[model samples]
Target: MKFIIVTGVSRGLGLGLTKALLSSGYKVAGCSRSRSDALNELEMSNDNFKWFPCEVGDATQTQTFVSDACQWAQAPLWGLINNAGIAKEGVLATFPNVDSDELLQINLNGALYMAREALRMMLRQNSGGRIINISSIIGSRGYTGLAAYSASKAGLDGLSRALARENGRRGITVNSVAPGYLDTEMSSTLSDSKRAQIINRTPLGRLGTVDDVAPAIEFLLSDGAAFITGQTLTIDGGITN
Candidate 1:
């Protein structure tokens, strides 16, 4: 049997991805800093799904989380979804160094650490695997007050490209899924005017949803996407265009 590790499964896109994978018949081991009632409910209802507490930004915690999840699954590592991330909005000059540092540490470095752990296990097993990082449209198209958040996501895309080249020969694939402004908690703080502006600019006339992005990820983890790697799949309702 094969199982996938998904980080930041407490809510929003992370939680949606977990449910998508579970429904797609894949076993999932998910991690987050803390548990929510929704997450606990999911764990209790699904035998194939498990949750662990982990601070993605902390290397030691990430290491332990991965190790423990793997041990509990007792199955080959099939894939990893680096979905755990946080966003802080402020122009670089005014953005607190501490906040920027924390954003990068989790959004970028945390993904690297998780990829490293998953790669090590995949290599030892001599089997193929998948690593899909959840990036954002703001990474490529910069925003006025999201300098640090943009940089972190851009770095994640770069990480995917480099890792794809390094692991393709071993039958492993790495990619990034950059979604447009979504209706998740991450974008909940958007003001009414900002939200309307975003919708007006987007060709679809509405913000993207978790449902719109999850199926693409489900496809990436499938054999159909074996030939696709080192690429960023933008699921933004043509907002980037």
Candidate 2:
């Protein structure tokens, strides 16, 4: 069985990806800062799913979580999805004192910690593996109020490329999935008019669903993507184009 570790599995895109992976018969181990009621309910019924309460930004906590997961599952870890992130909005000039620091701690540093530990595990196993970082379209393109969020995700994209090159010889393929505006809690605060405006600009004429993002991730984790690495697969409904 393919064993996978996904972070931020409490809600939104993370939760959706967890459900999809479970339905596809993969053994999934996930972590979140706090367990959601929905995740608890799903855990009650799914034998192949395990959820951990972990703060991915902390190096010690991240290491412990992966260690425990490997011990409990006793399986070769095939994939690691660094999906935990935070979005804080503010223009570069007048951003609040704590905004930039907090956003980077979670969105960028957390991903680095998880990727480090996951790569260590995969190396020891001596088998090919996949590492998928969940970035954002804003990572590549700048927006007015999303300076901190954009910077962090941009860092993630660079990290993915570097890791892909470093670990390619070990059969580990590192990549990123950059998604555009998706209809999730993260984008819920936008006004309906604003949402419609974004949709109008997208070639698909709609905001992407979590489903659209999950399949790209699943495909990257599959054997078919063995030749693909150091790339960012953008699922933006052509918004970037």
CA RMSD per model (angstroms): 0.7, 0.8
Give lDDT per model, in order: 0.94, 0.93
Off by over 4 Å in 1: none
29-53 per-residue lDDT for model 1 (tens digits): 9999899999989999999999999
TM agreement with the true structure for every prediction:
0.99, 0.98
Task: Give the lDDT of residue 232 in candidate 1.
Answer: 99
Candidate 2, residue 40: how far the Cα is off, in Å: 0.6
**Pairs of colliding residues, candidate 2:** none
Question: Which residue window of length 10 is worst by lDDT in model 2?
Answer: 88-97
Error of 1 at 222 (Å): 0.4
